[model samples]
Target: MPAEKINNSNQAVAHSFAFVACVTCAVSTAHAQSSVNLYGEIDAGLAYFSNIGGHASYQATSGLVDGSFWGLQGTEDLGNGNKAIFRLESGFSTTTGESLDDHPHYVGLANDSFGTLTLGHQYDLIHDYFAPFTLTGGAGGTAFAHPFDNDNANNTYLASNSVKYVSPTLSGFSAAALYAFSNDAGQFANNRLYNFAANYQNGPFTAGAAYLHANGRGNTAGGAFEPVLLPGANRDVFNASVAKQNTYATGASYVIGDLTLAAAWSRSTFSGVTDADSGAVEPSAGFSNYEVSGVYQLMPSLVLAAMYTYTKGSSAHWHQGGVQADYVFSKRADVYLEAVYQSASSGAPAIINSADPSSSRNQLLIGTGLRAHF
Candidate 1:
C-alpha cells in the first residue's frame, strides 16, 4: 500500500507541470497575436527678434525642428506572409490646445511587402528627405531659411488630399513618389501638387534628389483700388490669378567619425494669372532661390551648426546666415540656443518694404528651447 501511494504522488506532480506548461504557451501565443504602440514629441521655446519689419515683439512657438505630434500604430498577423497595419497621427500646438493648422485627425495604412500609402494632409518629398540635413536639425531650430521660404526649408508646402508611396529599400537605395488632388470638384486642376524623390545611402554617406510642382490661385486685388483717368473708357481691373510653381533640389551628406557635412541647392518659379473682375488673362511673375548649410559635433551630446542662404526674386535678392548650439541631456530630451541674421542686397526688395528696392533691412533672432520625445 505504501508503494501504491508513492506512484500516485509522482503522477499528480507530472500532471501539475503539464498544466502549467500549457498555460504558459497560451499566454505567449496571445502576446504574439497583438501589439499597440504610442509615440510622439513636444517642442516649445521663447524667442526674441530685432527688426521684425514694422513690429517689435517677443513670443513663444512650438515645433521648431520637428513638429509636436502624437500617434498610434499597430499591426496584426492575418496568415502566411500577410498582415494588417494602420496609423493615426495628430499635430497640435504645444503652447496651446489648438490643432496643427486646425487639422486634428490624420490617419493611413500599409500592406505587407507592397508599400505604404497615406491619406489626408502630409509633407512633400522635399521635406521628408532634405530638411534633415539642414542646421534646423542640429542647431535647435536656428537655421536660416530662404527668403519667403522659397527654397521649401520652412515647410510651407504641405499637400492636402495627398497620397504617398514609399518603396522598400534595396541595397541601401529607395525611391518615393507622391501626388495630391485638388478635390475642387469641377476645378480639378486648381491647387494640385506632385512630388518624386530617390535616395541612396551606404555606410556614412547619403544623397538624394527631388522635384515638386504646385498650382494654385491667389487673391491680390482685395485692397482699395483707385483708377487713374485714361484716354480709353474707364475699366476696373482686378489682380486675382492662378499661380504655377515648381521646385527642384539635390542634397548630399557625409559623416566621418563625429563630424558631419551637408549642402543643398534648389530653384523655384511661379507664374499664371486670372483677372478677379472678369476672369481675364493677366501677366505672370516668378522668382528663384538657393541655400547651403553645415554642422559639427563638439561632443557626444553637443553639436554646433550654421547656414547661409540667398534668394533672388524678380525684383530683389536676399542674404541670410545663422548659427546655434545644442546639448542633449538624454536620447529623448535636449536644450539649445540659436541666433540668425539677415542682410539684403541692393537689387533685392527691402526686407521691410517690398515696394522699395533701395531700402535694406537686417533681422536678428535669439532663442532658447527644450524638446522631448517618446
Candidate 2:
C-alpha cells in the first residue's frame, strides 16, 4: 500500500479484507499511474439475530461483514522516481442509503527511495500493522469484530487532522507512524493522538506490531477520536471521554498451500474514566484480547474461514466465534453466508459489534449477502 501503488490499500482489507486478510496481510506494490480511478465496494444482506435490545430480530444490513465505500484515487508521475498522490473515500450504509464515516483520505508525495508522506484523515498503527493478524482484520470481518472493537482491530474509529509517514520496505520490513493534532485553541493535549507500527513478510509468514497513545481521548471538541470504548452497556454511565488511553498489539500469520493460520493479542487501557450520568470518575478500565483464526481456499471461487476470540476485561470477559463461506461470481462480485456466536460472563449481557446487547449472557447472528466492487 505504498503511495506508488495506487491500486493497493497498502494492505487494506477485503470485505475490509477476506480483503480482511489480504487487505491487512500484505503491503506489496502495484505500479502507480497518472490517471484517476473510481473505486468502492457495496455489501448488502439480510441478518437474523437472537437478541437486539432484548428481542430476536431480523433486518437488512449494510457493510455488516465488510466495509462499504466509494472514492477517487489518482497519482501523477513526477519523474525521477517521484510521484504525487491523493485519495478521497466515503463510507455508506447500503441498508438505509445513509452516510457513514469517511475513510482515511489524504494527499501525499512519494519517491521510490524516500517512501511517502501524507496529511489528512488517516488510520493509526493498530489498524495498519497489528489488525491484519486478527480475525476482525481479515477473513472474519464484522462477524469477528472484538467486543466493541476495543483494540481497533475492527477499525471502529480514525485519526483525524493528522500527518503520516510510511517507509520503503527494507529486507522485508516496512514501518509507519502518525500524529493527529487536537486543533483546539489552548487545548493542545486534548484528544491529540500518536502511534507507530512496523511489519515484516517473508515467504509464507508475516508478523506485525504497533502501539498507540492518546491524551484526553474524548474530553473535548478536538476530534482526534470520539471516545467510543464500551466499558459497559450503559453509555451514560460509561462516558465516551477519557483522560488518557494506551494500547499495544502484536500478531503473526503463516500460509501453507491453500490454508492459512493466524493469531493475535492486544491490550488496551483507558485512564481517568468517568460516568457522564453521575460525573463520577474511576481509576481506569482495561481490556485484553486473544484470538486465532484459519482460512482455506477450498476452490478457486469458493473459500471458507473461521475464527475464535477470547477477551478479558477488568471485571468481565467474553468468548466469540464465527465462520464464513464465500463464493466468488467474478473478480468483482461474490456471495457469502456467515454465522457468529458469543457468550459473556454471568451477569454481563453478550453483545456483538454493531448489534444490541443480549438480554441474557449469550447471543447469535446468521446472515447471507452479496458484495461487489468496481
- The best candidate by lDDT is 2
Overall lDDT per candidate, in order of appearance: 0.63, 0.84
Pick out the ten consecutive residues of candidate 2 with the lowest summed lDDT.
24-33
The runs of at least 3 residues in candidate 2 whose Cα sits more than 4 Å from the true structure, single-residue gaps closed, are: 1-33, 230-237
Q: What TM-score, over all chains together, does every model reach?
A: 0.75, 0.88
lDDT over C-alpha atoms for residue 289 of model 2: 94
Runs in model 1 lying further than 4 Å from the true structure:
1-34, 79-83, 102-113, 137-143, 217-241, 273-287, 347-360
Q: Please, what are the lDDT tens digits per residue for candidate 2 over residues 59-158?
A: 8989877879999998988789999999899999988888977477999999879999999888787988998898778876776888877888787787
Per-residue lDDT for 353 in model 2?
Answer: 78
